[model samples]
Target: MSPSLSIATTVSPASLAGTLVSNSKNVLCSLHWKNNDATKTNRNLKFRVCSVSGGYNTSVENVPFPRDYVELISQAKEAVELAMKDEKQLMEIEFPTSGLASVPGDGEGATEMTGSINMIREFCDRLLAPEKARTTRIFFPEANEVKFAQNTVFGGTYFKLDYLTKPSLFEDFGFFERVKMADRVKPEDELFLVAYPYFNVNEMLVVEELYKEAVVNTERKLIIFNGELDRIRSGYYPKFFYPKLAALTKTLLPKMETVYYIHNFKGQKGGVLFRCYPGPWQVLRRTRNKYICVHQQESMPSLKEVALDILASA
Candidate 1:
């Protein structure tokens, strides 16, 4: 199917996974480095997968098989748990749902989007106990996805599935009405997970509203899962067009902790900006089968600086 899709990533060797860019019927099974030569240094990585329809015959013994997405989700779940344990009420976990080669917020293509949905489901399974699941609310970008999740990833779970926005008839052309959190949030809900709010600009604004109304000055905690808040931080949406979104960089963002993050920069001098809570920010470059930290700092570095300076220099 589709010539067995392959892509590159800057994720660490232990958790390397390429973007699975097919429909829901396809499954990404097994990943192996294309370059087996130990002496030849490889800058870019190639991830190969077998689709479910492809019989899943590919095998890699000794080396981990099919742990790509699992490892990433596991690490992300740990980061979120650490953030909550540290008393962080507002937190973020941003990574490319697609492979590292793809830009975040451009669009979460169907394959990667489903990957994220499944990742969220597995993440919650590992993150919350059965009793805790009943008190947690998970918000999707729109009402339609909530229905999908109810039957798929979150099936049989008492955890609530809600939405941030509702699409109007003109939604296909980038128009959607924001859903108010006042009517959606329950008093029993102790935690909220907002998933992929960057689909529509209004979604994140609604997220800010959720924080102010339900999360603030309370024991409740909020985690933005794959929201792609960097679009606002990097000024991708012009301040003139999205002033409220731009304001979040100064207001809501500073209070939030990025518990886990992975942003890849691709070019002649390619590298990944990686961070996991309680760990320092790191700039990593791929050399053959391994990733070496080129630079690291305590504070988060701007994406622009990471691309132009850190990656360029490293």
Candidate 2:
């Protein structure tokens, strides 16, 4: 018989795994975080694999989702079932662009000043000088109003007036303290406001046309996500604005912002991050006098929710 040609090979655990995983001939298995949508909106952080084959050919062993992954799923479910008791407090403000110091248009800058700090102090010292103008409508109509009213004092330009509200937008996404009123507090109260650079959209026909045709029509039809569209149809306040009413969502936006942040994920060592992407306008729509954004019915738990659930189970 011809000399026998025998050869043998050995592999370290690490080397064996690396060799198996990289080989096209070896069977491959992997699990990745995938958005429900095939397009992959949010992919998972960690991917697990047992083998590497062009197709499913490897005999896989017990490979589990990371602990955090299990928890992520659990949290997602909990978030859905748990009561979303958040209130959306819409601040409906009405003010003229170049005119108005008295009407307290939309509860923004309803206070007026007399002259200087010392002037206000001296005025408050007088019989009606306490620097208070609550009942007085001196700040409403810009021109006819007396200039001396405490609440009527402001710079001629309204540009910076709206600029101050940006910080408040960041407040809407997270925890805030309100007087826990007789209305009973909900878990989430959407505290945010919208401002207009001009008096009212309706006051300007061009503004009005742009608002309806350019803004809402296009935004609602093309821009609105499925959830937002359903809400507009339902007419939800804090979210609802009567669309039939002659109103304008002006194009000129005051340079301002509102923002919120989502933090703390279980599986994610550093925590997952979620935030609201800015939109064209902080505007909502309503028809026939009803709220539109009734919360969408939850189909399933989100990854974050599932993470929480896993934590609880553990």
- Best candidate (score: TM-score): 1
Backbone clash numbers for all candidates listed: 0, 50
Global fold similarity of model 1 (TM-score): 0.76
Q: Could you estimate the TM-score for every candidate? A: 0.76, 0.17
Q: What is the lDDT of residue 308 in candidate 1?
A: 88
Q: For candidate 2, what is the total of clashing residue pairs?
A: 50
Q: Which lDDT values do the candidates have, in the order given? A: 0.73, 0.22
Candidate 2 regions with alpha-carbon error over 4 angstroms: 1-234, 237-274, 278-314
TM-score of 2: 0.17
State how far residue 154 of model 2 sits from its true place (Å): 4.3
lDDT of 2 by residue, 201-306 (tens): 1212322232333233221110100011112222332324544322222222211111111222323322222212121111111122221211111122243443
